[model samples]
Target chain A: MLSKDFVGGLITILLGSLYLFFAFKQRVSALADTVGPAGMPKFLGILMLSLGVILCVQSVVHSLKTNAPALVEWQGEGKRFFRAFGLLCLAIVYLVLVSILGYVLAITVLLTLVALYLGAQFSGQLATIAIGGAAILWAIFVLLLDVPMPSGILL
Target chain B: MDTILTLLPDSLNFYLVLPAILGVAWGIIGGSLPGISPSITMALLLPFTYALEPSMAIVLLASTYVGAEYGGSIPAILIRTPGTNAAAASVLDGYEMNLQGKAGLALGISLYSGVIGSFVGLFFLVMLSQLLAELALAFTPPAYFALGILGLSVIVSLSDQSLVKGLIAAVLGLMIATIGTDPVSGISRFTFGVSGLLPGIQPILIMVGLFAMSELFKQASILEDLRVKTSPRIRFPEKKLRKRLILPQSIGALFGGFEGVMPGAGGTIASFMSYNEARRWSKSKDEFGKGSPEGIAAPETANNTVAGTSLIPLLSFGIPGSNSTAILLGGFLVHGLIPGPMLFARSGDVVTDLYAGLFFAAIALFFIGYAIMPVCIWLVNKPRPYLNAFILALIMSGIYSINNSLFDLSIMLVAGVIGYFMRVMKFPFLPTVLGLVLGFMIESNFRRSLLLSGDDLSIFMDDKISLMLLTFAVIFVFGSLAKRLIQVLRAGT
Candidate 1:
């Protein structure tokens, strides 16, 4: 029901509060300067908190003046958010598998699965592109650039 | 000039030449893709620079910027979509010209105008950056602190609709910056016992995550556009058309030269302003949007000119005015080269090498732009799924190569999610990046100035340079606030 600005402001406030708590907890040394190490962090925290409050106030004022709820909505917003979340999950899976499966295998599997996930047909052509693409990347990163890749269980 | 001859031998080196050509080729390919921005294109290349010499690495990144700016027009002319934000204005007359079967001519004019703009931008960059750097030589700790504040002040302009949100984003970035170590003291602040956190989260990781990975995430949710397969040959403008284009190109160059130097007023704005001005000045103003050569010439020239002139701030003041230049600044940091007045004194050769590299990039843009046309068409026509998948794979691989640590990869993915939410929230990324990049400098200098004055705040007012920069920052912030207030009042009325 809240506007995006109101929600965002709340989140910023939460973050600022947490940051301020940690900043206050930071230890200072006897040799530390007059303002010390925690000074900027403390300043940034207060600044963020103040700005967040201002944003919240502004959003509330705007809603009151317009006499509207200002509910945030976008067409297909949920679907898009979920789809993006899915891709991120898949990337996380790739990261976990990468150390176990090695760079070439993990990356090849990632390429194929992501392609299919994004609406590619499960054809031999897709296979070739995925395999070929992974191999080429391998050659470029490991061979030409001389940068090491995660070897893992399989070469 | 004696400067040119002195730098000639270094310019002719094979190491520099190869990166310039390769960077341009890669940039044209990357930029011609609709979703790939110049910053993302450059960020994708950031990890690879670890193996390169400092000069070579900087050249590669800088040249990519040059190529990418020009490359954006390919899609603007061929398809209705602009490849980069700056190329959006080109879509009007560019696509119109394509529709009228003058696609090749349109392509030629874009390329030609872009080169002219590049040369013009380079002239200003060479002339002005040195002068500015000389002026900045007198900077004290307070002055540097004020400089950082001045850089951060651009956030007000960067924030589209909300100063509060922009300040919030910048504060968040500053918080992230504090996670590594306390600059004045030897104590660590908020590392949470993670070894990787000690390095304070590399700006490149944040950049690649924010710009490239977040873009991919967004693309995943959207339906891919149906590919249009048409290979339009490029044809250079004849003498008559060239003469006609001169006025519009000059207008673009001047606008771009000025805009590129201002923080946050990047290529997109310059292109639009140049297009409008060119229309106002044109004798055949009636043809402004109906496939007018001037329309294509103006925006294209302005955007490409921005590729050179945008570096002026980065070179002179160590301040990155745009996303692409921020990535370039990352390149400099990667090489242990700090950009600023001290940079000129310490690494003058690198500066000269950059000049040489940009010169090579401009020449390479002319030749490579023609030869790479078919490749650009073919690449863009490929299935969106394959392109997205490969790009993701590239990002993952590139992030791993940085420290050979999986922790960095995780951090990058987290940053990507933050970037995605930031996009959804309508929060700008540049201010956050500016904060992250400039945070340490601001904090260190602020503390140092205070230490010198025994915690007295008046030391900032005591120094002339510091006073001047702080006054500028105040003007920028208040000016932005006043403008926002006016808009709010008008809306209420």
Candidate 2:
């Protein structure tokens, strides 16, 4: 199996190559001064590619010397990764629905859902905490700080 | 004396005082919670500072740093869990003292030592920043570019074992910095036609996503025991105990003052070094780990000392040496203030105001550290889910408030995911942040110098300041590489 460094290095190489491609594609303005806009990006792209290769080489050398996989296995990491992914999905859902549901309602739902997902018991107390927390935040951000939160037909 | 009188009224003004106290109070609450680091705490507050006066915003961020250092000890003493990374050193003695039913005394010593350390750090910060700022007054474009390179070189030291990974992360950051309009040509490079991407991503957004959101994701996955057995009232040390603690506190101050100014060596290293040094020099070496007051005092003092001195590099050269200072730099940028030698020249009042604010923050820490204990304990005892949920809400709300644009929120989420992967991959974050913050400075200055010298590359070596700075960068990179090589060779043997 490929080591984490090897996988990470491959990803970086792909990213650097893509970035370099974009840098080259950037249209140079007639008024472009010395070095132009693409210069730094081009440099960064090559540097990243070089570093990725170095990392890949280093990992290979270390693995050969050890004669064993140096892969770090965190207990229940897969489960944890899924849990985090679930949380991210929930956040995305909230973002998509926020403007439609309005700030207060959307935030209240977010608070409740996040709490439940994180292992809080579903109860009246949880509802109260979620509703109350949303109200407080709304007051602080909207009324106090004068930041206009997204609003919809629903309160 | 004249300077003191001149700064006295501004420092004492209600605007500054209120923010100072409020910041410290908030910091203590955030810091006392396990897993909420000082950087995250400050990052959560970064957007809020957008609406604040520049001086007040800076003071608020700076004071949070001061309070967080002391706040970290509360959990370290009470629950055997370090609230911040720096507080890890305090756990050895602090938890032992708690087990021995001397928790109050340990807390007191930590607080007292922290204040002493802050004052010591403040003295050095004031003396050194002024001198460095003065020296940096002659910086040309090439010199600024060299300074940025020098800042980037700090990444070598920051990359604990993997220099390659650190450089990759930094390169990624520089790439992100390139996503907006080009500085010189006024043409969009990588915006991909998104109007929001035209201004580029705000550093604060990236910071909050990386430090706060990614940590939340990690915390959501892990189940930890957050129970506290008891809340103890703090007891100030008696005369005899105070005398005994003096030596360790001094040692902590010395180590902290040195480490705080050095790029990439923050409170964590300083605290650990102080603990080791304090034990080595102690008369009660046998009691060092087993509830020795000096043990708690040394590490606590060192971390808080770093709170003040860490600002030295940021103020003098616009280079943040640690995560917390980077957030503070974000605070400065939000208010259209750029911190450096020119900062002192253009906004000298802001610099003086920061000094005043720090002095007041130290004083506030003493009182707030005591008064807010019950609250800190109460907060720590809360269920993890609710706390995490509220924090997530705060992050979303804060990110939206920055531009009232949903696009920024999306960017933040993307950055958060990237940060999560980086954490899993064991890439150091400071390098990425440094690259993001310094990317423009490096690129613009490099091009500006070349343009001025008619595309001559030697302009970098021609300027005295630039030459000196470049030399330092070379030494730093080479030195770190050499050290790493030796470690690898020794391991092979």
Candidate 3:
């Protein structure tokens, strides 16, 4: 059985140290009082560093203790994780493409891909959901709410 | 009182009623689904309220919470699964009652209890918030700063399992809040040369991404085939049974009101505690988990009661007491309105409208829950893949609709990933959000107070209100740690 806390704690510790360095290096005005622009960041950095260290210790202790609750990672869960991660990657690419491809086109394409990922095919149901859903949202957001969406190239 | 007379008529208008009912309808659908929460529902629907009047928007979000609290019991009774966390206790007797061929009875009791609890909770909301607001009217900048610190200190209590993880999350949120231009210095802090960062990151983006997107990502792992019967489920309680429900309902209202006012003890805890108390005092205690009416009534009533009363802290001190109210805080800020004692003094009319609308939502829950139970059950039992896809599309489109920035979309996706990691590690999400909400309050006020004085730290100690608030914050953090330590030591022994 493997637990997530130790790795999470290590990440937090690294992030905390980075923030602590950034906080200490910032220069502010002489008129600054006991705390200034750097004050909050420094305080938070120290807090995170200390907490992360303690969490790392706790995770180690719990993992070693015989009486501690078992924390198991299921086999084949990696496939599920990657499946969701793949959707996230698709999202990031679609976001970048929105600047050039326009929201309607990008969204239609993205939604089609998402529907497919969720098991829908490039059939009528997928077309109606992907295209219709995008059109309806564009109308609601742009026409009704007056939100200025990117028209973009090839719209 | 006069404001209520004026605002009561406005709450019934199409603008207010439509969103309120619609939010309720959406809330029920969301609540009846196992993974969807009241906060997530509110977060998803928040962007849609951009076109709504501010008063109407508040009503819409608040009413959604009210409806979701009751909607959670539907799945609890029909299936063994509790839709919302607050409904977990209801499953003990609710599902048992269902197995005994009394599903409608359990649902009817749940609805009745929710309405009664809501009315009682609303009374607490009006009385407590007004009283607290009156007290807060005398607070200066230093006091407000201390108050914000006190709110942040709740992370200690909210992180019941591990305070260390909670602090890390809060610190992360505070650091994120420090992005954009420094308020006091009039200089850009961490914009990384983006013009959109000038106004700082939108909390709504973070909220939708954290709650909605993370849930969508999490849904990829869960594969369940939910089933719902088309049988009509409209059973009203007999007069004799209604008499038996009163004691547990009263107990639930008491526990709910008490917990709602507390920062970290939310509706889930309140319902569970109320169930214990209800069973302890009931005549038929042996039937507690074996299809007793009191078991269903106690938790359902208690959780729903938290809906209105949880807003007391938000409305009075500009500090959200729960995650759902945190989203409501976002709703307030989106409209360029800040809530506090000033809100009561300035926008008394809007506050009145919200109260009237809450009153309307309580009554509306009964009619709406009865009318739409079958539809919600059908929707709940629908295939997960299509449902997840639709929700994901709704969230992404909704996020893009607000400000229409590619950068904002990226921020949301990043937030969703961070939120997912936080969830995986069992860290509390509430503190991170409160930190974000209260970060500006704590920083701006702390510096402003010192600048107003001649670099005098004693000014904070001099002001009675500010000193009291800081003292309370210190005690809260230290006291919670000490209590948790004692419990741990006792367990080890």
Give the range where candidate 3 chain B is weakest over 10 consecutive residues by summed lDDT: B1-10
> What order do you get sorting by DockQ, best first?
1, 2, 3
Candidate 2 lDDT by residue in tens digits, B1-493: 4555666788778888888898889888888999999999999999899889899999999999998998999999999999999999999999999999999999999999998988888888888887787775698999999989998999998888688898998888888888888878888989888888888878988898898999988888997768888989999999999999999999999999999998889999999999999999999999988999999999998999999899998998888889999899989988988887688888988888888888888889899888999999988998999999999999998999999988888889888888888887788888888899899889889989988999999999999999998999999999988988999899979
Query: Which window of 10 residues has the lowest lDDT sum in candidate 1 chain B?
Result: B1-10
The C-alpha stretches of model 1 lying farther than 4 A from their native spots are A67-69, B483-493
For each candidate, what is the lDDT?
A: 0.89, 0.89, 0.83
Tell me the number of clashing residue pairs for each predicted model: 0, 0, 0
Report the poorest 10 consecutive residues by lDDT, candidate 2 chain B.
B1-10
TM-score of chain A of each: 0.93, 0.92, 0.88
Candidate 3 Cα errors over 4 Å, as ranges: A1-3, A27-34, A67-77, A121-124, B1-14
Across B391-420, the per-residue lDDT of candidate 3 in tens digits comes to 776787788777766777889999998887
Compute the lDDT of residue B174 as modeled in candidate 3: 87
- Candidate achieving higher lDDT, 1 or 3: 1
Q: List, residue by residue over A1-155, the lDDT tens digit for candidate 2.
A: 37778778888898989998999999899999868998898988899888888888987897798776555544477788998888898889889878899888999999999999999999997999899999999999999999989996676
**Residue B374 in candidate 2, Cα distance off native in Å:** 1.0
- In terms of lDDT, the poorest run of 10 residues in model 2 chain A is A68-77
Angstrom error of the Cα, residue B73, model 1: value is: 0.9
| Residue A127, model 1, lDDT | 97
